[model samples]
Target: MQTIDMTEFQSIDLRIGTIVRAEDFAKTKKPAYKIWVDLGDLGIKKSSAQITFHYRPEELIGKQVLCVCNFAPKQIADFMSEVLVTGFSDIEGHIVLATGDKPIPNGAKLH
Candidate 1:
């Protein structure tokens, strides 16, 4: 497997954020949700997640999730996604979110 140096790893800004809002994203080819995350000092950011298999829009609110915060904004259909909600694929290839075991301050860095 390819490995990255410490600096390269550090360059990836991974942080915890709370999901403030979520809604159905109808304009995309695949099923996804348009979500808003409260990142504390970083302010609220938008993301598109294809996690419909395991989550619902209402259930996502107030959920703390790990996010890749430094990526450039990506345009998905009609949405501008500003952060990446990190997750691991389950044995069935469905995504399960990466999250903290307990609640912590938003915008907390993953070290």
Candidate 2:
């Protein structure tokens, strides 16, 4: 794995956001969801997340998740993904969302 210094780590804009909407991305080559997150001060951002294996659309709403906000928007299929929904792969290869145990203010940066 590539290592990064604290300065580089700090440069990444990792913040908390609440999932406000989710839907299957019908046009994507891979199974994925087109999700919208409410990032408080940062406003709502859209992401193409490959989390359908472990998450259902109904269950994702209102869930607070971590996101990488500084990355440039990426295009997936016909959609423009504005942010990255960060997560880890489970033992079974399903994506498990990265989230805080306790509720924090939306758009709060990771320290």
In the predicted model 2, the residue pairs found to clash are: none
lDDT of each: 0.98, 0.96
Off by over 4 Å in 2: none
Candidate closest to the true structure, highest TM-score: 1
Which whole-number lDDT from 0 to 100 does residue 105 have in model 1?
A: 95
Supply the TM-score for candidate 1. 0.98
Residue 53 miss distance in model 2 (angstroms): 1.0
lDDT per residue (tens digit) for residues 57-98 in model 2 = 999999999999999999999999999999999999889999
lDDT of 2: 0.96
Best by lDDT: 1
Q: Candidate 1: misplaced stretches above 4 Å?
A: none
